[model samples]
Target: MKKITQELIDRFYDLLSPCRLCPRNCGVDRINGELGNCGAGLEVKVASYHQHFGEEPPLVGRSGSGTIFFSHCNLHCVFCQNYEISQLGQGQRVSLEELAQYMLDLQNSGCHNINLVTPTPWVPQIVSGLKIAQERGLHIPVVYNCGGYEAVSTLKLLDGIIDIYMPDIKYSDDQCAEKYSKVKNYWSVVRSALKEMYYQVGNLKLSRGIAASGLLIRHLVLPNQLAGTKECFKFIAENLSIKIVVNVMAQYYPTFNAHKYPEINRRITLSEYRAAIDILKSYGLDAGFQQTIDTLYRKAIPEWGEWS
Candidate 1:
């Protein structure tokens, strides 16, 4: 495979000056440190970096995914699990060279891939860092972990840079999306983004039990939201190829400001999760991990070491 280069990095940096990077289309002048709706600028602010074992089995494997948690997000969901980092921007600012070095450090620590968490707003910066890291001999697969509301044009810039695409299909209904994530046209934008992602990477691929390329669509089952889950699965089956790896996550806990919304203000019941699984099975989409209800509350709270 062709390696990411410094020229690519420089080009990405140039594009971020006046950022039109995500679906929000904030067009914030990020180069001069102007904050957008996402509350982020040109420089990357990272909360933490480490090898995370809590991801999907294929991505995590035995070692773990080299996770670099980027601060702030384009779609600031009310029930965000990582609200501290994504909402409050609780992290230190680092240069492109420092971020590249962090990737190398994780690789040296025996991680399987470089997993970028909530990287939509900082896609340009991440791409630049990846190129620099690749030049410095970083060879692990790059995982573009993001919320599903991505801009297709922004993702086009990462055509060859990112190897694995793991995007969350949060909601199938725009009303639910608006009520929960505060994004009005969430489903429409995310559906288009998913199509673009599926077109770019096609179906999921694995080598020796490790994911190298392709898409992994994740749907987190929420309380009193089985119908939404069914709609999302049906759409995936009809629109995209059913051969895609779909992870039906049951790790929904009332976090951040979820209490304000009564519908999703609590943990998902076992029945709710099972109903979602039943819907996926009905569609003949048996591709990814199913989070157990017992395991959901076992570690509900986010730990500092989770970044590690």
Candidate 2:
């Protein structure tokens, strides 16, 4: 693995000036106190941070993945489960130095890895913090948990900085993406982003049942086939690799503003979830995890942050 040098950190911080950190490419000078489309400024805003066991098995093995949830996502998903943080911008802004301490603190708490949730817009600050943390002997794997609407150029900057790439393959259809997430060309953008992510980290690699590095694709089974599960699986099996770890998430409940769309105004039925599993198996992409329908229902159905 290439070392994350001070020069690399400087280059990443430069991106914040023009703010091409994510796919949105708002081009606003964030260094001068301008907010981008993602609603982030020079300071990093965090909703919460905690040791979370609700993540994938590999990520949550033994202890837990130290998750830092960022505020205000780039994609405005109408049915977002965590709308309070992602849409409403509910988080406290902290300096980059303080953010570095959070990473070290998670490591001190015996977290297996530093999992960054919704971290795309704040990549510059993240990289800066990682550099500081590295100097302080922070050596756990860094997980880039994002919504998959990433820019290849931006991801290239994180080639060695990020280890585990846990990204959502949200939609295979641009129409559905635009209608639901208010993002343009979501299919193409995510497709290219996934390819770049795979190229950077390859297939998911585990060490002692815990994720050490590599790519893990997350495909949430949206109701009424809006997420295009079959298409996403086909693309992964053919274009990427069957060896890639894929989490066919079945916890699609109508939360936030999902009632506005009748098609996705309910939880995914058992048959729907079963069909998605069948499709996943048919593609021969079998190295990942799945949530049982019973497990989803047993959990409290609330539109809240995972940190709380």
Q: Using lDDT as the measure, which candidate wins?
A: 2
lDDT (10s digit) by residue, model 1, range 188-298: 998899998888888878898888889999898888983288889998999997777787777778889989888888888888878888998789777555565565668
- Judged by whole-model lDDT over C-alpha atoms, candidate 2 comes out at 0.87
Clashing pairs in 1: none
State residue 113's C-alpha deviation in candidate 1, in Å.
Answer: 0.2
lDDT of 1 at 254: 85
Q: Which ten residues in a row have the lowest lDDT in candidate 2?
A: 299-308
- Candidate 1 lDDT (Cα, whole model)? 0.83
Per-residue C-alpha lDDT of model 2 across residues 180-280, encoded as one tens digit per residue: 99999899999999999999899888798788899999889888888999999999999999888788787778999999999999988888878888998
How many residue-pair clashes does candidate 1 contain?
0
Cα lDDT for residue 215, candidate 2: 94
lDDT of 2 at 237: 96
Query: What C-alpha lDDT, on a 0 to 100 scale, does residue 96 get in candidate 1?
Result: 89
Model 2 clashes, total count? 0
Number of the predicted model whose TM-score against the real structure is largest: 2
lDDT to native, each model: 0.83, 0.87
The reply for model 1, stretches above 4 Å from the true place, is 5-7, 299-308
Q: Candidate 1 has what TM-score?
A: 0.93
